[model samples]
Target chain A: AAGVIQSPRHLIKEKRETATLKCYPIPRHDTVYWYQQGPGQDPQFLISFYEKMQSDKGSIPDRFSAQQFSDYHSELNMSSLELGDSALYFCASSLFGAGGPYMYQETQYFGPGTRLLVL
Target chain B: EDQVTQSPEALRLQEGESSSLNCSYTVSGLRGLFWYRQDPGKGPEFLFTLYSAGEEKEKERLKATLTKKESFLHITAPKPEDSATYLCAVADTGRRALTFGSGTRLQVQP
Candidate 1:
């Protein structure tokens, strides 16, 4: 089975620079979620999109923004990157149900993740 | 606010030892509870999802059970290959994203 694909598995950037991370979700999965995991910490929810629309937001920084394209792929753009931003970024995809009690069964599958090192 | 808490910050077991990891959560309107295994420097691998209390799911040497306030992942006759950080997360009715616990780091020595 094809899993979610992430671009630039490893990235290095300097302070104040800009970076863009791309994620291609699994086929037929309509929802994409982004998370950041700092060293020795658990993954934190950043944002999520459902059917190309922003469905939810979490602790994402103001300097960071994300969007899902028409093809169901998503991108996370960060500006004025700080050293504290260094972490592993992960993208997860899930097939969302139309709407009903069964929507609770949506299971998310994750990608390999991108390691960001801000220098 | 939704909160997920995993116990035993770290656990060490010998090959073939059996143990269980706990994840306690507090959320309004629980949507689902999930278990994932993550290797060093890699994304989390999905393990199981329990949608309601009394639900149970299993895969290989792992079994997950959920109740109203907590979930448990039991590993039986584990091998070193099963060593990894096990994360527990939950989704609420208000959001599509998951709120994760810090995770339990399991080290199985062969």
Candidate 2:
């Protein structure tokens, strides 16, 4: 009940097809973050959601968009997937307050990640 | 430009060997430094968070120490289960974004 949950653990999509990944943040955690890790590389920041709005976007393409619902569920949509987009996508959540009334310390709790393969 | 750099892109050690990994940074004001361990196909597992210089934290066989400009993760008598990519990240004072390093891959063989 206090961890990040991502849907569709693995997905394979044809090139140029649309793919969507979903995430459910921990209760009372207002911040949701997403990262993409390619093979043999570190995770790169994709975007973040705070207060039910898109707060930041990294160097990702316009084709990649995310939305946060009122219930703190976030969805990442990729329109027209490309081979380069194939990677493991991770979702994380964190609370904004200063101290440890929150769960899992101040560190973000990451989901198991969604493996997306755009062939 | 905020940046984080990890050294010794890769390392191999026999079981029971000890080693240290380095993470250097260049930022205006450092709010936090984080260390994470990641397996081949999994998300990073948070290990430590250093907020100031001369601060240190330990868990099991790993100890993390921090300085003004860099941080070090020392592994004591590592085992095969310690084999993973260790990533370091920096969160500046003003922003919530985290700048991450390329990471150091450790392979502990039996």
Candidate 3:
């Protein structure tokens, strides 16, 4: 089974710079969620998209924005990077309405996270 | 606000030892409860999802049971490979994002 794919598995940037992280979700999965895991902390929800539309938002910083493309892939764009922005970024995908007792609830499969370091 | 709390910040076990990890959660309306295993520096691997109280699921040496307010992950005859952080997360009704617990770090020794 093909899993979610993330690009630029490792990244480094200086303060005030810009970075973009890309994620390719699993085939046929219509929902994509992004999360940030800081050192010694649990994963925090950032944002999510469904069918090219912004479905939900969490604690994502104002300096950061994300979008899902027509291909069902998504990207997280960060600007004026700060050292505190360094962390592991993960992308998870799930299929909604896949017939089941709980059609709205689906299992999310995660991709190998991208490690971002801002200096 | 949805909240998840996992107990025993860390655990150490010898090979073949059996134990259980606990996760207590509070949500306005329950959508799903999820268990994931995460290796250091890697993304969380999906384990199980329990939707309602009295629900149970199992895989290999692991079993998960859920109630109205909490869940348990029981590991039986564990091996060193099972060493990792176990995370519990919940989705509330109409919410697309998950609220995660701090996780329980398990160290299995040979």
Against the reference, the lDDT scores of all candidates come to 0.94, 0.87, 0.95
- TM-score to native of every candidate shown: 0.97, 0.93, 0.98
Per model, the share of native interface contacts recovered reads 0.87, 0.47, 0.76
Q: Which residue segments of model 3 deviate by more than 4 Å? A: A99-104
Q: What is the docking quality class of candidate 3?
A: medium
Model 2 lDDT at residue A32: 90
The better candidate by DockQ, 1 or 2, is 1
lDDT of 2 by residue, A15-66 (tens): 9999989999888888898999888778888898889888777867899999
Expressed as tens digits, the lDDT of each residue in A17-75 for candidate 3 is: 99999999999999999999999999999999999999999999999999999999999
DockQ (CA atoms), all models: 0.84, 0.45, 0.78
Please provide, for model 1 over B52-96, each residue's C-alpha lDDT reduced to its tens digit, 9 standing for 90 to 100.
899999999999999999999999999999999999999887788
Best DockQ goes to which candidate? 1
When sorted by TM-score, best at the front, the candidate numbers are 3, 1, 2
lDDT of 3 by residue, B1-89 (tens): 99999998999999999999999999988888999999999999999999889999999999999999999999999999999999999
Off by over 4 Å in 1: A98-105
Q: In candidate 1, what are the lDDT values of residues A1-119, reduced to their tens digit? A: 99999998999999999999999999999999999999999999999999999999899999999999999999999999999999999999998872237658488999999999999
